[model samples]
Target: MFPPGFFDRADPSPDHFFYAPPRLVTHIDDQAIAAVGVLYQELGMTGEVLDLMSSWISHFTDPPERLVALGMNQVELAANPQAHEWLIHDLNHTPRLPFDDNSFDAVTCCVSVDYLTQPIEVFTDVARVLRPGGLFVVTFSNRCFPTKAIRGWLYSDDASHLEIVKRYFEAADGWAEPVTKQCIPPGIPGDPLYAVYATAL
Candidate 1:
């Protein structure tokens, strides 16, 4: 659904080097973060959960029974308080997840999807790892590292971002009809939160 250079980035260097330092800061504001938590709760994100592309905080108000975080930086993943287990992995280099089939009940990627150069492969692997009818929730905002973010993401608006993620799920082909929502209401201050989610088939 995108052009040849859509996934290209300004910084074409290795992702590990870009994420070497631990960024403990939250990308979105408190309100947007709270909205993410509320969405997770409402979606019944229980059981074994995989926090994909996770950082120092999972933003889960009440975490699930077992939360495993997979990210690029070891220090950042290790610092996540909500994660019961953590793995240092880069989806940009290896789109295939190192997890067993039906391993997780829910998978979440927050504010990090824009950096993925191989999102379709990652989404397909996410579906493979999820249990039947499990949720794959991808939340994002306008804020992103311009140098690392995909050209398509940097060029697109919020509505286009939602459609982008939705198309990813559709292309993956193992998910139910995706749902898109504006998690944070309009006219609210700070970064806006939006979600594109679907259930594994």
Candidate 2:
């Protein structure tokens, strides 16, 4: 749990305005991006997958049978070659997901978890949409749009960011114990990658 102002952002404008323009850039470096793909492969991320808060790239070395991307920018979602289906949806505005229960085998949010103002609600919905024992992988690095990130995320360090995401799954109360990992080795790269993931109960 966090304080009242924890979710507030420096830029209080609607997320649509903030993400209106398509920025087709990779937030993390090549090494960090590779680490993300490796993690997905290690976790056996296949079947129907939901890429939440996605952008122009899913970063999958081997994409799943079906990949659905949901984000705020249509152009970016459309540009994702790995995505089998894509939609423009704002999680901050509406935490409820449009998919039916048990629709996905796995869900991923890459490098964009900090922007979620209603993370717990979104996480709960993610759980609802996932089948039992489905994995929900959340990966992130230090890079972020500072003005759009939550106050708590902006104020926290790397270790605290892991704890914050772990607590999010806990608060949602529909996941198994979350596992945190340093995807990219420390002190050897452009941007350090971290992950906090759990399986839906």
TM-score of each: 0.98, 0.98
- Cα lDDT for residue 30, candidate 1: 94
Candidate 1 to truth, TM: 0.98
What is the TM-score (0 to 1) of candidate 2?
Answer: 0.98
User: What's the lDDT for all of these models?
Assistant: 0.94, 0.95
Per-residue lDDT of model 2, residues 67-181, tens digit only: 9999999999999999999998889889999999999999999999999999999999999999999999999999999999999999999999999999999999689999999
Q: What lDDT does model 2 reach?
A: 0.95
- Candidate 2's C-alpha runs over 4 A off are none
Off by over 4 Å in 1: none
